[model samples]
Target: MIDPTDFKQGMRRLAAGVSVITTMENGQPHGFVATSVTSVAAEPTPTLLVCVNRNVSCHDVIGASRSFCVNLLAEPELELAKAFSSSAHRHLRFSTHEWRALATGAPALMGALASFDCELAETVSVHSHSIFLGRVVALHLPEGPLHPLIYAGGQFDTLGSRARTL
Candidate 1:
C-alpha cells in the first residue's frame, strides 16, 4: 500500500473546490468543510457524494438526519471555509446570516455559488470515512460570477486571472 504520508502529499498536488457540508438535527446545525464532494450521476437521478471522516462531530448528525447541503464556496467565502474546517470554531459555523433551511431542512448557504440540498440515499463505509450518496432534491444557483475557492499544497488558493481559455 502507498504510505499515507506520501498519498497525502500526492493528493495535495490536485486542486479541489472547497465546500461546506451542513445538516440540522433537532433544531441545531452542524457543518464541516469538505473537498470530497463529487457528482456521481445525472441520468436516473441527480446524485452526488461526499466523504466524511467518521470521527467528525457532524458525521453522526448527517447520518441520523439523512439530509445535507453542499455549499460550494466562492472566493468571498474564505472565512466561512476556515470556520467550518476547524473544531475550535464549531460554535461559529452557522453564526453568519447567510444560512437558511432549504427543502431538506439542511442549512444552506444563501449566497453560495451553488447549494445542493440533498436527501441521504445511501452510505458506504470505507476505511475511516463514510461516503454519503445524496439525491439532489433541490438546488440553488445564485446569479453572479463564480470565483471558486480551492485547496492545494496544504493551503487555500483561488484562481488568478491567468487561467487559459480552451
Candidate 2:
C-alpha cells in the first residue's frame, strides 16, 4: 500500500503556477490561492478545471454561483497570494488589491497576467475535493510586466528563480 504521507510529499514535487480562484458570495467576493487550475479543452469551447477542497467556504459559493474566474498570479503578486492563502485574511483579501468585474461578474485581479472568466459546466466529487469543470466565457489580459508566480517543494516561486538541479 502507498502511504498517504509519501504520496502527498511526492505530489508536491510537481511544480505548478499559482492562481486565485474567485467567485461571488452574496454581493461579496470569495477567493483562494490555487495551483491546480488546468486547461481541459481548447476547441469548440474552451474549458478549465479547478479543484476546490470541499471544506472551504469558496466551494459552497462557487457551487451557488456556478461561475468563477481564475486569475494567474504574477511574481510581484506574491504578497497577494499569501493574503488569499489564509482564511484569517479571507474577508480582507479583496480590499488590499485592485480588482475588476469579469464578464461573468467574478473578481479578476487587476494586475494578473491572465484571467479566465468561467461558468461552471460540470462538477465531480473525488475524495475531499470537488473538481469543477468550467467553460470559459471570457479571457482577460493586461499590458504590464508579467512574472508568473508558482508553488513547488512547499514554497512560493517566481520567474527567474534559481534552484539546484542534479
Candidate 3:
C-alpha cells in the first residue's frame, strides 16, 4: 500500500485555485481555507462541490446550517488564506476580515474574486473528507477585473505579469 505522505506529495502536484469556504453558526461566522472546490453540474440545476475534512471546526456548522459561501480569493488576499488555514485564528476569522452575508446568508469576503452562495443539496462521505454538493443559489462577481490566487506544490501564486484574459 502507498504511504499517506507519498500520496499527499503526488496530489500536491495538481494545482488548484484557493478559496475560503464559510458558513454561519449560532449567529457567528465560521470558515476555512479550501482548494477542493469545483464545478459539479449546470444543466438541470447548477451545483458545485467542496470537499471538507470532517475534523475541521467549521465542518459541523456547514453540515448543520445547510448553506455556505465559497469565496474565491484574489491575488492580493494571501493573508486571508493564511489566517483561515491556521487554527490559531479559527474563531477570529470573521472579525479579522470584513464580510457581508450573501443571499444564502453566508458571509462573503469583501474583495473576493467571486462568491458562490449555495444550499447543501447532498453529501457523500469518503474516508476523512465529506464531499458537499452545493446547489448554487446566488453568485457575486466583482465589477472590475479578476486575478485569482493559485495553489500548488504547497505554495501560493498568482498570474503575476501574465495577461489576465484567455
Candidate 4:
C-alpha cells in the first residue's frame, strides 16, 4: 500500500474549498469542518456527497437525522472553520455565528456563500470514513460575489483576491 503519510502529504498539495457539514438532532446542532464535500451529479437530481470520519460525534447524528447542510465558507469565515474543526471549540461552533434552517431543518450559516440543504439519500462505508450522498432539497445562495476560503498545505487560505467569475 502507498505510505499513508506520503499520501496525506500529496493530498495537501491540492487546494480545496472549505465547508461545514451540519445536522440537527433533537434541536441540537452538530457540525464539522470538511473539505471532502463535492458534487456528484447535477442531472436527474442535484446530488452531492460528503466524506465524514465515522468516529466523530456528528457522524452518527447526521446519520440519524437523515439530513445535512453543506455551508460553503467565505474568506472572512476562517475562524468559524477553525471552530468547527477543533474539538476544544466544539461547543462554540454554532454560538459565534448567525444560523437558520431551510427545508432539511439542518442549520445553515447565515452569511455563507451558499448553503445546500440536503436529505440523506445513501451511505457508503469505507475504511475509516462514511460517504454520505445527499439529495438537494433546498439551497440558499446569497447575492454577492464569491470569495471562498480554501485549505492546502496544512493551512487555511483564501482565493478572494485572485478569484474571477466565469
Against the true structure, whose TM-score is highest?
1
The predicted structure with the larger TM-score, 1 or 3, is: 1
Lowest lDDT 10-mer window, candidate 2?
Answer: 157-166
Superposed model 1: Cα runs more than 4 Å off: 164-166
- List the candidate numbers ranked by lDDT, top first: 4, 1, 2, 3
Superior by lDDT: candidate 1 or candidate 4: 4
lDDT of 2 by residue, 3-91 (tens): 99999899899989999999987888889999999999898899999999999879999999999999999888888899889987777
Clashes of 3: 0
Instruction: Give the C-alpha miss distance for residue 166 in model 4, angstroms.
Output: 11
lDDT of 1 at 161: 65
lDDT of 1 by residue, 1-166 (tens): 8999999999999999999999999999888899999999997999999999999989999999999999999988998889888888777778864788889999989889999999999999999999999999999999998789999998989986676242
Candidates' lDDT values, in order? Answer: 0.92, 0.90, 0.89, 0.94
TM-score per candidate, in order? 0.96, 0.93, 0.92, 0.95
| Model 4 C-alpha lDDT versus the unseen true structure | 0.94
Q: How well is each residue in 84-158 modelled by candidate 3, as lDDT tens digits?
A: 889886666777767989887999988898899999999999999999999999888877677789899999888
Report the alpha-carbon TM-score of model 3 versus the true structure.
0.92
After superposition, candidate 3 runs with Cα above 4 Å error: 163-166
Runs of candidate 2 exceeding 4 Å displacement: 161-166
Q: How large is the C-alpha RMSD of every model relative to the true structure?
A: 1.2, 2.5, 1.7, 1.6
